[model samples]
Target: MTSATRIATLVAALGAAVALGGAAHAAQGEGVSEVSVSGHLPTQVTVPLAGKDRTVVRHEVRLAAGFVCRNAVTNRDLEFSDLNWCSQRSRVRAMRRYDGMVARGMLTAEAPVIVLSAR
Candidate 1:
């Protein structure tokens, strides 16, 4: 094959590999645990990522009815919206009722806007 053809093929393959790698990361990314943040929520959270691979600081949170978490860094109040209520949600209750903002994901917002779902 010509050198130009070979180079083009290599570039295409490299691009494909990079795309697939990103897709895998998206698939492997940590999912939001079925939980909510307590009232007067936290402004920051220290999330342990990838099987204790590393820790990340997250800000901005979504507090549901029964969230039992807090950020050791910033003490920001969480305003919750909507969330999935499960049968095993015996721990979540009122008093901790937040703004009910319908959301999911980490107790903080260092990452993208993610919401949790049972399905």
Candidate 2:
């Protein structure tokens, strides 16, 4: 009820707000719509992202040799005969991409985005 107490409370509230905003901003730096999806993988794989303010739509498909994608940049899927085994660097980059994506609105749920599901 005192003037001093009110001022102190105001200052504390402002600091807390600043801290939260900073944390949220730091979490989402870039608007990563989808993962670059480099490297290699057996079998067929396709990742689809729903529409959002960030981007309309995105589809990254990696199918078997015979499988094919009628379209690459659109709703259509894609297939590659040979896998690109670049290096662990690609994996790291993909992981970063996944993190950035989760930070952004691309991924809403709190789950493992980059799942290295190998058989």
Candidate 3:
């Protein structure tokens, strides 16, 4: 094969591999857990992330009910991976708390905003 042809093929293969790698990451990403809050509500709460002492701070939001409220984590970096990882970990921790609340009959239908504070 000509040098130019070989080079073009290599470039195309690399591009395809990169695309597939990204797709795999997207597919492997964590998903939101189901936590039904029928009535129990807190103005603010702190949820510690799994395997880490860091916690996520969640503020009560009127627009989104339950776990859909806005969230932030303590000492979170602005970088892409840092932001995404912190957010994901916070979400997971919140869901776990919600599940516990449900199990313990803490969930209510009042739909009040719960503020989650972390340090």
Candidate 4:
């Protein structure tokens, strides 16, 4: 095969592999029910000139069928702080925690509203 043809074939194969992998991953969570959870939590963040500060932010938790957050506090209003989930470290941890919950049938879907403790 020509170089161009070989490259195209390889790209197609890779695309197919990725599609299959995604399908498999999605299928693994099929038939699961999720709950709409909302709450707020306190997260520390650094201000440009104000240094470090603690803020209460709103977050949503979309939990899958069988998973649950033992420490999840829901239905709380975002009155404490005016910020959403901020800070890279805190955000990553929150995402990982949410992903873990979803993986174990806990949650899915996230948005900025109310509060859902992802800590």
The lDDT per prediction is 0.35, 0.43, 0.46, 0.40
Stretches of candidate 4 exceeding 4 Å from the true structure: 42-119
Model 3 stretches astray by more than 4 angstroms? 1-78, 109-119
Better of 2 and 4 by lDDT: 2
lDDT of 2 by residue, 39-97 (tens): 43342233333333222221122221112222221222332322243223334444566
Top-TM-score structure, candidate number: 3
Model 4, 80-99: lDDT tens digits are 23223322334445546544
Provide TM-scores for the models.
0.27, 0.26, 0.31, 0.30
Q: Ten consecutive residues with minimal summed lDDT in candidate 3?
A: 60-69
Candidate 1 vs candidate 4: the lDDT winner is 4
Ranking by TM-score: 3, 4, 1, 2
Q: Which predicted model would earn the best lDDT?
A: 3
lDDT of 4 at 83: 25
TM-score of predicted structure 2: 0.26
Q: Candidate 1 residues 1-119, lDDT tens each?
A: 99999999999999999999999898876774668756543322222222221112112122321233322112333223212232113113221222231233333433322232111
